[model samples]
Target: MKFTEGMWRLREGIRIDWMNNVERLRVENENVELLLNKFQRHRGDTLNSATVTASVTSPLEGIIGVKLVHWAGQVDNGPHYQLASSSGHTKINHEKTETLSYDSGALNLAINTAPNELDFVFSGAKGKLTGHSWRSIGYVGDQTTEKSQWDDGIFFERQGYMLAALDLGVGEKLYGLGERFGPLVKNGQTVDIWNEDGGTSSELAYKNIPFYVSSKGYGVFVNHPGKVSFELQSERTTRVNISVPGEELEYFIIYGETLKEVISRYTALTGRPSLVPSWSYNLWLTTSFTTNYDEQTVTGFLDGFRDRDIPLGVFHFDSFWMKSYQWCDFEFDEELFPDAGGYLKRLRERDLKISVWINPYVGQASPLFQEGKKNGYFIKRTDGSVWQWDLWQAGMAVVDFTNPDACTWFSNHMQRLMDLGVDTFKTDFAERIPYKNIQYHDGSDPARMHNYYTLLFNKVVYEAMISRYGKSNSLLFARSSCPGGQVYPVHWGGDCESTYEAMAESLRGGLSLMLSGYIFWASDIGGFEGTPPPALYKRWVQFGLLSSHSRLHGSSSFRVPWIYGEDCSDVLRDCVKRKILLTPYLLAEALAGYNEGTPVMRPMFLEFPEDLNTYPLDTQYMFGSNLLVAPVFTDEGTVTFYVPHTPEDSQGKWVSWFDHSKTYEPGQWYTETHGFDTLPILIRPGSVTPINPKLKAPQDDALNGLEVLVNGSLANDMAVQVVNPSKTHNVLKVIKIESQSGNVTADDAGVKVVRIGH
Candidate 1:
């Protein structure tokens, strides 16, 4: 994706025709065609012919979309993110002589038709709104007209870009672009918005969203689902440049007073996350990958936890629960789970829910394969051959989510599973949908559907679950997703290794995805790939249990605590208890996420945008707005975090929830070390944090006492949304409390707790 070498030359076969002047401009309906020249004077210059077309489409109110196209007539059906929020098209009046202007959402686009200049002046906070330059236009190579180009181009997408390289001060950093594990601040690296299966080590990401938040207080979302390459002061030392191949490049320039506001507006435009059940936040045990387990093994694990007084809420059966190479058969491996239905009933009797792992692949060995093939449920080539591959399973064919019948056929199996007490689904493998030479029943462009396919696939399964169960009761341990996939509830960092580095990288990825509007995120506790050291397992357990959805899963090993050591049970028990106690507070934050489109787990910038020190600090994140969680990634059990010294109002008081530790002043950096038994969870001034003392299952009544922790100098007020015990995500009560003295009065109106000293 890089076209330039260093600061001067082009890299190898890269040819960039930087447009200097717009020689000729033609307007036809909603399209504007431009003929450009690299130098100045040009009548019919064939040096680098770039014909650019800008199609104006408003997908949502207060937003204008100008999709720039370079090559015409290569409209292929492929994978593309579906933008569903465009509306209210105001008439665009063009001034004579090609000088045209249109305004929307305080953004003014002034076009100098003759000079081929398109300037977007965002009327941001005072004079802080940014603008795009002239050299930002121009498309990449031609789109292939060949029929087989769909699958090959899944890794790439067409784009249009305008770039600026601003200096990152001596300590300037970046954060927020949907759960990334690279540098939290993307100032010194090159990033690509392409989803991959690479674990949290290299730059490759499983959920590569085309968005980034800079510490400089602005976010740029390249509105493309394919591949978008960003050089964050990497190639150009002074600027961040993004390049996408194709006839069109579209990105948004968002500005706000703080990074949180930027997220507010971004999620408003993309999609807000949903509120998951309170129990979903509790500890989840899984039959880890490659581990031998049956009903007896599962019962033994459950019994061990019960004997230890560890409350296990959800039990997930990994891929092996189904017959080998017969994935998605929707039939539990009878050899292993002889009575899946009866076992589920037993789990329900124990007040535990069950979840199963499934992908969209329809293996030939699966009984549903023939039904899908006969009913056109799978994607097919132009030759009418079902697209089959042996990557994960033998003759695995992808279900054509674009086909209504295919979705119905797939949903039916899940619906039946629900009838048998399957509560949730781990919707996996959506990132690997085959695009090339495949045909969708809806006649969708295959290339545009690769990334978008994840949405429909998840939606089909998610909707079926919701319809059969209830909306509030629906959840998915989904792996792959696009922009709007936030509609699904919970997602985990896919396929992590058993190591501290991978654990840290998983945190980075989760933080990045959280920025991209995902409300919930979890990773395999103690990693998913290799056998983790006991130290690593204990550390990962603390981190995972603290997350929105905690699950102990692995690829080739069992994640039962005793397998690591007897001490491991103590670690898991401690974290699980803390999570249960904090469920009252976490669920309230989730409700706010439902309303605000923000993440319960947030990067540093989302909390303190003005504090440049926290921008690149991805090692630590805020569980909600109040508490800061810095996961220990080393054997030393040491964590280094920066707390924005906020000036206390009238009363100077800051308290630590773990221990009523000390009072710290505002506006300074603190390097506080913690033991494996604790992490830095600072409570802000004038905040109320809710803790359920009952500490039963997450869904148990939270109305009694509801020990609201009042951390130092509580000035303003705080609120807690009392979760309904009977119904998931339903608020039985919204308590607004004000704490000044020993007595606390519940505010007449509701409030969200801010227990941290910010």
Candidate 2:
């Protein structure tokens, strides 16, 4: 994707035609069109050169889109991200002699139309955000050379690419390129927005979204389904270079007053995350992959949890539930469980929901494979044969989701599992799609469908679950995702190692995904690759139980807490009980994520954007708007975290949630050692956190024993809304508390209130 050798020269066989000057500009009803050509000194200089056409329009009130086309004749086949747009009005001002401006809400795009000055500057009410200037827009071509090799091992006569570079200001950092694991900040990195099945310790990502929010109160979304390569200050040091294949490239500039507002506008254009069921917020135990497990093993795991006094919510069956080499058949191995339906019914009687693993693949050994191959339900080659690969399964063929019959065929199989009392699905492995020499039934571009296949794969399964269960009950533990995939809730970090480094990497990935508009995220509890040490397992349990969703899954080994030690089970029970008590506060944060695009596990910068210290701190995060959670990554239980200062706090102080008497000054770093049961969970000043002390499960009535923990002094009156566990956006009751002479008093007579840091 890199075309330049340095600043002065291009690489071999590379040709770039940059947009130099605007020859003509036309405005029609808030839409601006520009006909740009290369730098011309005379009339005959424009005879044989190519011209670029640019269109600018407002999709929503606070967003502006720009589409640049090198060749306008290519047909846009299909497989586009579903985006929502409003018919927002904009103001056009071309009367000025030097600049032509378009205003959408408070965001303004001013184009310098002075003779040879072709610059596009985006500004807000505060100041300028970012812009494009000289040599920023170009059409690149790679002619065949000795070393010219394209992505798919095929060399073309001339491959075309369109690129645009935006300015990166001093001290500005970029974040959220979709579940990245390298670092929180994306500067000085070469990121390719292509989905892969790579694990958490590399630069490759399972989810690759082409949207990034900046520290300058703005964000940019590249609207391309295929691979979009970004050189974030890596190539040119002061620019974000984005290049995509084919004839056209489109991008949107979203502006907001804060980082959270930028995410709100971005998700409004794509889709909001759906609210999951309350029981899903509790603990989930799964059969480890590649481990020898029958009904007895699963039963023993469940019994162990109950005997240890730990609350269990759901039980999941991994891939071995099906026969070997016959996935997507959706049948339990009769050898393993002779009475599959009866066993599921018995588990359901235990007040537990069931989840099963499934993927969009049909091995040749499966009976459905022959049925699909004959009915044209699988992806086919150009010769009309079903495409086959022997990677994960023998002779595995991908289900063609482009055909409506194929989708129905796949969903019917899932419904069979649902009929057996299966409550949800763990949709896995859509990232290894074959993009070469294969064709979709709908004739979508193969490279584009590679990343988009995850959406179709999850959408089919999610809709099937919604048909069986209601909206609030349907959930998917998905792995791969794209731009519009946030509508399906609860994705997890895939295939991490069993080490402390991987645990921190998983947190970084989850925080990155949350910033990308995803609401709920989880990771493999004790890691997925190896046997975790007892200290590592106990530490991970505390971190995992505090996440939006918690699951214990691994490969080749069991993830039962007692396998480590007896102390591990006790630590896990303590964490699970604490999470059950904190359900009222967690559900309220989830409602904010469902209504707006606020993340439940958000980075520190999202809350304190004014503090410079919060931008570089990815080791800790805000669990909600009020509480800060710093997970203990070290086995020794020593953790150092920073408490941020905000303008609203009269006395800059934060109170510890574990011990109410312990307080810390803001804008200072503190290091503390904790046992297996505690970490640094700090409550923000002047905030009310609701807790249900008597709840046994997350689905219990929150109003039964609700108590509001008031931190520091309340300067103003506030109301705490206790969300209903069974319904979405339903608030059971509001507890109004007034600040009387710096003392907190609740209006509801029966509600108990506790004041901290008095």
* Per-model RMSD to reference: 4.7, 2.4
Q: In terms of lDDT, which candidate is strongest?
A: 2
Residues 582-621, model 2: lDDT tens digits: 9999999999898889999999999999899999888899
Model 1 regions lying over 4 Å from their true place: 6-8, 21-48, 55-64, 76-80, 84-103, 106-123, 126-129, 141-174, 647-653, 671-673, 715-718, 725-730, 739-743, 746-758
TM-score for candidate 1: 0.89
Report lDDT per candidate.
0.72, 0.91
Q: After TM-score superposition, what is the CA distance of residue 148 in candidate 2 from its true location, in Å? A: 8.5
Across residues 231-307, which tens digit of lDDT does each residue of candidate 1 receive? 77777665567776555677765555666666666777777776666668878899987888899999999999999
TM-scores vs. true structure, each candidate: 0.89, 0.98
Q: Candidate 1: lDDT of 573?
A: 87
Give the winner by TM-score: 2
